[model samples]
Target: MKKRKTLLLPLARQFTVILILFTLCTVCITIYSTFGYSRLQTSFLNNSLESYSAQLAKSTREAYESYENICYSIAYSQVVQNYLMSENRGKSYENYRQLENQLSNTALLNPYIIDIAVYGQDSTFASLCGSASNYEEFSRSLSDSRFPYRSAGVATVNRTLCHVLAMPIYSLGTGESRYLGILFLAIDVNNLLGNSLKSDENDYDPRILFTDASGQLIYGEPQLYDALCREEDRSDVFQIQETSDNPVTYAVTGYSIPGIEHTLYVLIDKSQITRQVARISGRQLLVMCAITFLALLFLFLLYRPLIRSLKQLTDFMNTISSGDRRAMKEGAVIHQGLIGSKEISEISTAFNDMLIETEKLNHTIFDTYTRMYELENNNRKTEIAFLRSQINPHFLYNTLTMICGLAAEGMDDKIISVTGALSRIFRYSIKGSDMVTLEEEMSIVRSYLMIQKERFEDRFTVRYEFSEDSHDCLIPKMVIQPLVENAIVHGLEKSLEPGELLIGAGRNPEHGYLAIWIFDTGVGMPESRLTELRESIHRSVYNKTGDASADLEDLNSQNHESIGILNVNSRMVLYYGTDYTLLIDSEEGVGTNIQIRVPYRLKSDTNARAAQNTNSKGENHVPGNCD
Candidate 1:
């Protein structure tokens, strides 16, 4: 029974989570864009205010320069100078009637000028006292003051703010270099600044303030005097800042009027920039919202089919888990709507094909197992039949020939022993099993060697070296006897001198194998001959195209190498696998040594590879006979 999952969520709820995540991403992007735009707009407005302040300052400077030029005109005039140094020095400037009339006409021509006054510098009775305004206050104000040339700034006149331009008077003609008296001109703010600054569109004109080099106030709106004075700084340049208690932002900048000793400060409002930001922000919000809505709609359309296909696949997989073959085929039609997408279609097709293949493979697997059993049985029958064919008449014929030759020589004892060893060898080879204990195979090898020693008593010496631990090891039958036989027939039989033959059986410490060696101190072959013999053994072992079938002809080959060493090598390979090799090492005129290695498994251990050397890898090898 399957346990119900407690944490499982429906597909719609899962999609709802996706929708929420998408909305969060949209909100984050919107907030980031809005923040960046606000910063850019603020920076632009700050820069625009600086430019507007500079332009206003320039206009204010031009307005104030006109007053300075008027002051210079009177100071350098020849008519004004002669009148100041009148022959009638005893009289006041009123006695010079033409000078008074000239001053009054100058003031009338320029409506901006509030008053034009000239005061005498003489230590004696003062000369050339005149006022353009025809006001007694101008005379009284002028009489008390003494100023240097080019002194220009803003001042209060008749309880009204005014721009004042002043300059020193020089003597006429030859006395032009000499200073005589000071000339003064005061211009009304409304008349002088209105044309350039005041707009009919709005009352919000940028106020221009004037101050002399000494930092004294010259001219500005009287109402703004206190506020501006409070915010006054030592530096000539201005900055935009919010007022201490006001919501509005204001900017100020100062410019020095050329050729005049005055600084003009232009103050502008900052609300003009704020209005633009509000308008831009409104438009941006509308555009972003519309895009976000469209994006959400697109996401819904995109993921809707995917979610439905996945839901169908999930249900189909659940039914598949219950071993329903119908669900696999049914899945194709269920998610058919998603087939337009290549990846989804491939996934669906693969899922169905895999399930179908798995079902067909179920029956094919049993057939394969049955075939494997039949093949193993055939291999066993083939190996036994090969051994029966090789060992029966041919081996008996060799023994009978040896016995008949011995009988002709009248050696009855030799024939009896040889016949006994030959009979034991034939019986062991014909046994239907391919496994034998190291002790049992060594007994057979000794019996066989005993017969050879009798036949060649004076030709060679035979020695045995067997380790006690390896005596009971299970290995392939007749694996070592052939190597000893080869040493006797090929090595000692051909040599003129008596040879030494050694047979050794021991545990190979480096590998899990029983090492059996046969060494002969006879005339050995060269390195080239040894390599040739090694290749011959390899060909016989791997005789078949594949090791799937047993090659019976490999055991029955009558070639000298194929008869003894090759047969031994091929049989050991077929039984103990290729890791077991019949290694032959020889040197010219020194000796020849042959080593046969087989897996060392104990006879008493039922789980280990026993006589047949069969293991879990399905390796079942037969007992092989050698010359």
Candidate 2:
């Protein structure tokens, strides 16, 4: 009776339900089956193709690299390096040939190399075993190479064409001017490629050919249409594309050989396997059709329920796509179907994470630009300050000269020493415009010490000792003088008894820097003052002002008495960075010490060299040794 009611229902409604269900189910099943089957086959074949391609590529790459290695080994031979260094022009042709012969015999792996060409800088080409017939042709051909080594030619032997590769040999001299020669290797590319691609199976064979950038064949001369031959347009194709399908049905890969400036390709064919994958089964198709009809009948019985479930899925997708992230965060529009899924939830999470990262990236970029702008502004101001500071020393030097002249006329015994020291100090101030020798800075320090001794006579003594090797090391001018002056005025001037100020300069073997120390036996500083000085030396302008209770606060916030120390420290850091200079150690009652470490070698700087001559005037006199 139920079957009869169903049959009596309107045919269109019943037919539509069954047909719709059948089409949906069969379409889903067939699409899944087809894609799954095709992907598996394609993946398997691609993997095989790639694996075969990789192995062949590795073999060919190793062969070419071996050839390159051998050529480089010959090129960098001590004999060659020594010959180039000795400036042996084209005269050492026989000696170069003997070297080439020895290298050819030594390379057991690639013994077929017939000749080597050494191209000298004068466009003359010389070879160890090549013939005289094509020497002119070879030389003319080589004019393009500029054969910085021996000769300008095709670098041939016996007038027979050969596979060739060459590398530019360089002299071990410093600077951009030391190139000496070009080393050429005449090789059998066919033999190299053949031996490298030797297959294990009898049925499989591989062939390789070498060509120039223009796609003209350069090697494998005897066989034109062999297993490997030049294709009509293959040469042009390889130049443009890195990878392409080989019309021969073989998997292929390309690599650029060093020194050759051309592409080498490797190939493997899979025509048979591809044909097998194309074969389909007729019986299976019939069985699939039967299954489709049965599914249609079952779906008509549950049409209403299916529509309701689809609506639920639609609503879930819409909720996730909404721009309101907060709504999604609350986990609204949950899927409660028997076939539950969490894919929608995961997508939402990933989207939110992406938004968060984008915001952070934007903020970081903005902050970086802002900080860069502020630093540029500060740099400009510092330049202005430095220019202003330069003006006063000239006037100071003139005043000292007049004083020294007056004193000299009166036969003051100490007048000459003071005048000389003061004069040197002024000249160095101008001379150290950019950089000065270690010898120059020491001169300034000696002069400053002299002035102090005259002002505070018999109160203190200073001594200096420096390594002979480190005398040539360059350092900033007037760097040491200011520190010495500080020590005398702040430490020794106040003392009654004679105090000792010992200055020592030497190279530090461990750090590769010059370590200079100024030690004084005078009134030392208290812990509070020492701490304040350290803070001022390291404090940045950005943190100059902050809450009073800030941790690591500036203790010298009252008066910038340590400004000189801070300035020197900052300048040292700005130039060589904090790793180099302005090290201070002090103790109450005992003494104070300052060490300035700088790189021990003058880094060939143009400005330093230009100022070297102008800066030699005042380095000889003792600063405070005047009687």
State which candidate has the highest TM-score. Answer: 1
For all predictions, the C-alpha RMSD in Å is 12.6, 47.6
Q: In model 2, what lDDT does residue 89 have?
A: 53
lDDT per residue for candidate 2 within 14-33, as digits (tens), equals 66876877688787787677
lDDT for each residue of candidate 1 in 317-380, tens digit (9 for 90 to 100): 8888887766654555445453345666678778878877876786699799789878876775
Error of 2 at 257 (Å): 93
Model 2: lDDT to the true structure: 0.59
Clash number by candidate, in order: 4, 22
User: What TM-score, computed on C-alpha atoms, does each candidate reach?
Assistant: 0.56, 0.35
Question: What's the CA error at residue 187 for candidate 1, in Å?
Answer: 15
Model 2, 120: alpha-carbon shift in Å? Answer: 99
Q: Which regions of candidate 1 fall more than 4 Å away from where they truly are?
A: 1-224, 227-250, 254-265, 269-342, 358-377, 384-389, 392-395, 401-419, 526-528, 546-558, 587-591, 606-627
- The lDDT per prediction is 0.68, 0.59
Ten residues in sequence with the least summed lDDT for candidate 1: 123-132
